[model samples]
Target: MKKRFRSTNPVVVGLATGLYPFLYNYYSNFTLVDSLGQLCFFVAFFLLVPVAINICIKIASKKIPFVAKNYILLLTLSNLVGFASLLTFSILGPKKKIILLVIVLVFLLALLLKKQLKKIIFLQYLLALIVAFQLGFYIINNLNFSTQWKQLPDTILEAKFKKKPNVYIIQPDGYANANMLKKPPYAIDNSAFENFLSENNFKIYPNFRSNYSNTVTSNSSMFAMKHHYYKNPKPSSKEAFGLRKSIAGNNATLSIFNENGYKTSLLIESPYLIVNRPKLGYDYSSIAYNNLSFLSRGFDMNVNVVAEMEKAIVANKDQTNFYFVEKILPGHIPVSKSGSEGKEIERENYIDNLEKANVWLRQMITLITENDPSALVVIVADHGGYVGFNYTGELKRKVKNATLVNSIFAATLAIRWPNNEVPEFDTDLKTNVNLFRILFSYLAQEPTYRNQLEDDGSFLIVSQDVPFGVYEVIDGNGTFVFNKVSF
Candidate 1:
């Protein structure tokens, strides 16, 4: 008889090795591959693990005959634990159910081929070792390395002032200024809005750009008063940990604000508000739908957020507050499905929603003014919208060719300072990175910081796919003092 060769199973070995990393990626939204990669890896590993076990049994029958009898049971138990862990930690949805099914099927198949199960266990152990080593290296490297400050500044100080002013920074997510909204149906003359502010003695910095394109970086930078440098395209396990640190570490903006004697309160709608990272040190923070159990219910998060803020203000009218209001406009998806449909229906709905939010804001402003007319109101946007090319354009095409998902419209900045000789700055001032610097100057009332602000030379840097072109606003006298991107 010819000698037979025993071989390890490729399917089970390859899959178990790949499942851990891909599952991690899916949870983090790290890449496009995550959606399908995890399933494929798990199935393959499950099927092949048995084959590897059989090969091992044949090879070691004489030395360890007992291994052949018990290997299948051990393999089955290990796979059960792995799958159960994945299910427990999953975000809970149809995706989770489908993944659980695959895990079950693979485990069953491995058990049916009990003779080959021993070989699979050996292979799985080896793969597990590799994964453990990779994780170890990542943790060590990320924690040991010193943080790099590539674009941020050091030592941001408020200008010296006579007395503390109640600060209100309102960020309207995806709100663009009027001139930039000139793309047909979405375009508004904005002159009316500008005139309203002008009459109210509000200084409008017509050309203010966001520090970054996304909320996480943009908001972090706004509070920290520093440039963000953590941009990893293919972020590894180590890189993800580093990003977590950057967002919630000791040097975060909230910590700085607390240190400066500001009683900080954040009213936000994003899920990030409840993320159990290290506390950045907020006096109080509330998100939309605080008690809602279902994810779909959280869709209308903005509505709940506005309500909470209104209640908070009404309940605490006596105290001077530093409020950071992150207003969630009807900008993101499910816009039409959020009980608002049809073309005209959506537009009308959007306008109505904005008006409602504006009404709440106006009420808060009135209350603050009544309490102290000298209160500082800094209104801006977290980012801009990526609606249609024009208001009436086909929504499908616009969605297909959406801007780099990074390009946001220029944020609107309308500041109202009380009791000061506010200059009639007719010419548009290009202000972006200097937002913190400007706020500090006004709060501290140090004219020297104003001099520093005037000397600061900075340009707005927007990513690709956005309509990238510089604009200059001329006053009645036709002087161009500021130049910035229109959208």
Candidate 2:
């Protein structure tokens, strides 16, 4: 019973495994407690599995008695694989369950054959290398986050409109325009949706695109009305915390609304991102940013957000003017459908989701018009699809082989005003950067002056391979010019 059984220290192993993800989330300013809770679970899962495996091994390997140190090594090795895979479950997509099952079965078999496993060496140093790699990954990502653009200050730009209307801006995530949606593969029939909108006096911009192909970039640009110009290497490292916060915290959009005496409301699917949400002046409702990791933001929660909108904005009898900005992600991957088998509907989940959102939109509009009689509704999409089909074809290509998430620059834009007088915008081939400019011009009754804020058909759209991945300037073109820059 000589004891030199050098078992892996669970504390070191846990921290080494969980540190990067923790830092990755922390850099984004997600709440520490939620992330810590998940990290603790991750550590516990890794540690408990080995203990369970070790107990089973002692039972199965009494006849095949082996060195205790070898068992420790196998457990540690199993832990490394398990915890790493678990932490990255979202990115692992469908294979995570399979991987977990495989790890469990392999470890159980290895423990049963502990006599042969005793011969396994060299893993001691290999485990050290893995820990070092994890530490390095955390350090690098931390540094990447640290060096992003400085925080944007809370701005209070003043603008006064003669008549204030309750504004509801629903930014549907990944909703592509009719051109991209009606393409051959997807062929999502948007005409019914458009006609419904048209009948209600919502004009769908047929040729509109987002200023950038990325969500944060496009939305931030749209709200700020200034495209964050991409440098040679994209200076912000794709996290673009400043850009994210400018919208989430201290952007000119919310400021203008606040200064104009509107009770602002900010709501999104998830509130944890690269910003201090409290700094964003909002009188009503919005989820605060934190470090909590969310898997799919459940269907019930999203449905409840609309219900909340109805309660807070649509059905509320308050006399104060309200400006509510919410992100309604209908076109999220695999697309969420209520009361279904979680399968794609009508061979086009995005379309189905959009239509459902349309139904909700109609309800909101009818309610608001009934309550206030004067309200503006702006329905826009952040970017296009990442699914196989999008706006990329030889006919539409100025630059060949420009498939950043299937040319996700093509975006959806539509606007609804009280009376059915079509306000003259700069152009139908407008990018999302000019969204507010159009509204300002129309609302101010001075298109000739307010049109100056528009992009002038020249703005940059950024492309990133992953979430906050290496940002590159994608190739695109405007209405007047043909260029390699993708929008």
Candidate 3:
């Protein structure tokens, strides 16, 4: 009988190779199609690399006795290093005991299975798939961000009696309404936020809801003066209008303001702008002051905003400045220092971050008010928090925690326009999109463009992760606005 050919299984090889790309894409929040394509590419590479190495070994040494052993060892070591790196880079600080314990357990398991891991082809493939999927998911979800805003009319006829005002757009990442702050051990205390607002002569919108649950999308919409809905259907071309279009086209609010002759400057705390992607129209952008390190990170959430605002004020002391500032306060993870014991450590850390953020906000506000009392300042959250959800729960959980990731509280969308002109506080109506429209109305002396303002006079908050429900603000109540759409 002819000797049977014994070769590695294609499925095993493909899966093993694909795992790296799959995990990377998933964690990086790649679209479905892109993730799959990456997976195929990685798999092909993994299979081909081994073949190439084997051929080289045969040419160099006729026997090539330990090629398989070397390959297995290489794969195993790479996995160990990759996982270790991931743990190192996770936003969750290393101080958490639970995280440390998990790391220890993972290390022990890796060591225990070292022998089997090297020999079992199927197991190796399975391990690769699991790691790739987990890492990919992490990257993808984190990267999936969005923002929106509506246009004001070309002219505000009511301005004859009202004062023309300067506008300030303040975006606090991961801020939500105080009413829905339900995460345990670190729920937000609106009293402090309220106190800050009242002291600053600010008008707080109790019912304001963000248009989208992300900084980039909501901020883009806010600046662009456009209402954006997440539409999965591919746009006809890259030039399409909407939030998707703005991001795809690299449009920025600075461009619009610059066109209208307002000097524009960005005081952003996040690294989004630093990644060196093309941002629209910033002839004199000053982002250096906020790019300092604190607590060993690239940017210190606690002090960056205050510093950036001060710098902006100094730079635009004489100019009518349209300052776009994104404050990284009270980050989504609310961890209190007092509660850093046992399972409560994560929560405590998150709260600690928020408290630091609040401190920064207070300082920034004081500086702004002192420097430019006539500036129109609007403070709002980019999106709600993603905390305290039972991922296993049927209604709350999905492929990921995307649906349950609503912010802890509605953001404090408070506005202090120039000339002490406070628009009638419509407690019954709220929308971040409308806030942009209203601000532009005051700035441009025009009616809200397109009547783009919703008839319901309420804000609509949507997310791709959470398709079944919409968070709406009406009559000063922050509640879920149910929609029939299912994804």
Candidate 4:
């Protein structure tokens, strides 16, 4: 039999398992040099963790083998633990006692059966597939993001704003549009919110749809004023982080706002992976979560920092020209379909959340107008959230194809001008990409900003090569028109 310590197979096994998840992400993401560099870097980095731990174990016990002998199972185990723990913790994190007990038991077992446990060889072939596919993927696809720094086109910065309005771009995650409120499932009355907006001089564009249903995808494109989705024959998840990096870092929107002397602020409401990496040059920042939440790992943002953000907004009301964005909880998913005032809870049902969001918007409007009446306040939902409602009879029938469920892309989009009036764009305009064009046009007093923007029309909510649905929206007389859409 081959001596386990002398065999090189463990090293191969350790390196492959460690690199799987890291390599799984791509969007024309890497060139040969980039992928190889990252693969080498992450493998070495993951291996070092176990090597260090092994050194401590060796120092503690004189007879303990080095990593070469053991091949350090922890190198692979750590990745397994990390990747597994995310899915585990997401489901079990709330049940701290169960997780703690399992962890303690696992540790105790590891201590007692250290010799026997050395044989954990999990999927030594995973690396083979990863390498083979990564190479093929690299050759097959063209990744747009090179290592070279890209300068925003001169046209983006050419127009200058005369009077910088205090701009507020508020994204309420999963907040469906007016049509959804009237759709099946929880058909709640949105007139109160509409009335509130009308009272405050806001235009409620019920026809509007987000470019993408996913928050990160929508925000990345909205900020850049261009599709951040990578250039590929197919769409893959690998470009996700790269797109997010553009959102979290200095993208075109933030750069233009900053260059034009708008004090920018970022508020992280949703606890997606991207929100945690926000190092943008915002003047005021408010993050509602702590490190524990990230470690716990969930796709939910549980808290609304509205009251906290109010304080930040109040602080700079009079002095500087500002652009602030906060993720206010839109109450897309509800805890219950029914509730009263005092029976309140964090996860209210869709109807309750919508009603409360209406109230919340009213309050925010008053606060903004009182402080800075000339502020350009934009209210947009990241994406529509009526997909789960498709379980019902009416909704089930409305969903005709994979391209789109009737109003899933229909997100609430309302904008308020400083003087309480928004410019009239064609009613068919739905995509958020043209928003900055309008905002920049209005703020900079440059009508050509309208000309510079792409014509507002049907855009695809795609899933790689296939069209999930097309966002072809047209509205009149409270009736909602939708394209055959889904992705």
Candidate 5:
């Protein structure tokens, strides 16, 4: 019996190796369609390499006949080049010397395998199959993460506001609650910031905590006005599919604002919020530019979102506007930390960013008050800094305590009402999940909507612990519980 022949195509292996880093880093943010589209674009990009190789082989055939005889070797060498170049720049992002070292190493390996191309074709196919399987697994797991709620409940929508003050939600990412900032682990003097808010007639919620720990999940619940209980069936700790859509798409809260004849504007410093290009419901969205590079870390490239804010405020002065201005200030703790010294360094870095955020806050408040004095501005954070522990491995730590857990879930929530017209429900505004509900109740002058607000329970996932690791970290009274619940 004749043995089945194996194709000597190394392009499949090259494409898979080159694409792995992008897909792995962003698969959580991407829907199945997004993943498929990216896959096709990359495939088309990688196909160019083989086409060029074949052209070179044909052109150089007469002069160097060995080129045509060793076509497989040329293809293999090109594949190796593609893999090394992409993996180094796209994922590793090492220094110049490190990149040179990687190129040199890949060149040496290719030379070593120059004569054995046919023998290792099976191995190449194996690697490609593995990547394909993993992609399929991610898509299958995240299929259930669809848009659960597209519009707000009827009670929230029917609520009517006698006053139509412009609203602004300013988010300083990862800024902790005032109480957490004043306590042990964080022990920083935030009185100046608090005093500034107070002078501006802003009421700070002392015991505010987010319903979830991460930005996407926390904001997902905030916009939906519901407790997720980590219900998306996380494909991995890193992947929370459909949460971005929950926040950036036509979310319930944004839809209601649109229905109420308010112009929704999104001012983002970085492209992080719209990285996957979710259909943002905001009538006017501003960003300097969308950097679509592979494996982008989502940092601002000198993009002045404050300028955009001022522009939006001035442009929409005549219209009732709801602005969601997000700035990644006082960002999360560095992933790389060593001993006590590393911890201290990271803490100082966080404080430095926090100071910058305070300055930005002052600028925003001054801009709004001077231009539109009757606007209602809210200063809310997505989640805490995860200061002491590695954010990714937070749930796996055995030494977890109530204070550490509380600090992780803590967030800043302060509201500046127009003419200090704070409503009675403002006192009950304890968590981000119920923040909009209380605001809607106040706006509609409907006290009954407050009764329907979800209980302010903070749920977090013990990512490393697996299948049944979802836990209630904070209860309705804003106290830490640390009790594990079924996932």
Candidate 6:
């Protein structure tokens, strides 16, 4: 038996052993403590397990006369097996039937690499450099965020408020606008929900569209009251540089509310936004998933959102409250529907969720009315359902008609003002980017703030398309115009 273990370079072995965890963290945008947890698991699995196995091999080699004196090769082979097993599980999920396939593939790969060992070594070094460069770039990008992050416009914090009504901004994820609901794929009879809002003296903006097609981008723009145009350049496709910070920490809307005498509270049904635990500005928060724990699993459904809201409302009833309740009802389908059968299934699922959303809306409205009847309630959506396409990226090619394109950007915005005190600027509220600007103006009784409101131009990023940049899908005058954004 050969005593030398030249085939397994420790750097290559380490990288192979830790690839799955690294990829997971990379995809998750390097969520702080979660990434740290993954690192810990990597160390234990890659280093500790191999060390223990090597110790056992050493012991066996000494005790048994026939045992191979060279244990380094055995240790290296064990590392390869561990890496292969983990990768196979990560890709194909936990299925016993796939084990034989994984073993066969690993055997074939080893045989091919035996003849081309030098080439394989060169490739491994190259991959290591690539991984290191990516990490370095991400670090540099984050360090520059202070200079690159979009600063909140001065107008938002300059306003003076006289009225201190309890304001509630309830966001239902992926609920299509009233017009789009009646259109194709969705053709939903959402009249019940609309009528309920109407009866409650809510002004439904039928043409209200989102400034951006995706949730993080749309809400970030809405809170900042400005179009970011996805300008915060990311190191990777899955990573977003400043959107979460804008949505949570340095939020202009939250700053305005806090600067005034209002006690702000945020209650979310899922951890999609708060999973990384960005510096939250709210005085009180009830999140569905544990932001602090990396291994935290499962999440409370939208049904529990009202209970949390009720608690928050009761706790801060004496002060002027600004509550943001985000419910993940009628959320966009997880996967893109490529075939006709898949698309039809996705449509049915979307409608089912929509129906569930209606029920939740009524429940939420009832809860609010019973507790605080004179409160200003704004029921809005983050973005449209993307009904024709399950996912937003699918719209790049699937948006063949106007209806499909509109469905991707159209979002619901309905506000029930206290004593029906609708401001003149309310009529001009066409997109969510200008949503808070109009509301703050109404609260401040300062019509001048409306003058500084951002243009109601809706923008979206469509990957795998001809012009791969932010496209202005809807103009300020509620007109559908496809123009690539210059800035």
Q: Which candidate is the best by TM-score?
A: 5
Error of 6 at 31 (Å): 7.1
* lDDT, each prediction: 0.47, 0.52, 0.49, 0.53, 0.71, 0.70
Q: Where in model 3 is the C-alpha error above 4 Å? A: 1-19, 26-28, 31-166, 176-196, 213-217, 224-227, 232-252, 272-303, 333-354, 384-409, 424-429, 448-450, 455-481, 485-487
> Candidate 1: where is the Cα deviation over 4 Å?
1-159, 184-203, 229-260, 273-276, 287-303, 314-319, 330-373, 388-409, 419-432, 450-487
Overall local distance difference test of candidate 6:
0.70
- Which residue runs of candidate 2 sit more than 4 Å off their true CA positions? 1-103, 106-156, 178-189, 230-242, 269-281, 284-301, 314-316, 319-354, 386-407, 425-429, 442-487
lDDT for position 178 in model 2: 69
Predicted structure 1: clash tally:
15
In what order do the candidates fall by TM-score, top score first?
Answer: 5, 6, 4, 2, 3, 1
**How well is each residue in 135-231 modelled by candidate 3, as lDDT tens digits?**
5554444333343223334443223313333456777777656554543333656587677777788877664666654555565555555554433
TM-score of each: 0.58, 0.65, 0.58, 0.70, 0.87, 0.81
Global local distance difference test of model 3: 0.49
Q: In terms of TM-score, how similar is model 1 to the real structure?
A: 0.58
Residue range 1-487, candidate 4, lDDT tens digits:
4664443233443444334433442212232113233445445544554345444543444454564354334433433443333223334333666666655555555444334433434442454475658756654563455423233443756668876777887777677777666755435677867887888788888767766545666666677776432323243423333566556667777777878866776665554524334454566546533442433233455435566557767776665455445454563433234422221232235556666666666776787777677778888887776445422122323344422443455678888877765556534346766667667777777776566564343233344233533443432222344554332
The weakest ten consecutive residues by lDDT in model 5 span 1-10
Clashes per model (N, Cα, C within 3 A): 15, 11, 54, 20, 1, 0
Better of 5 and 6 by TM-score: 5
Report the C-alpha lDDT of model 5 over 261-294, residue by residue, as the tens digit: 9999888877676655566677877752235443
Candidate 1: residue 249 Cα off by (Å): 6.0
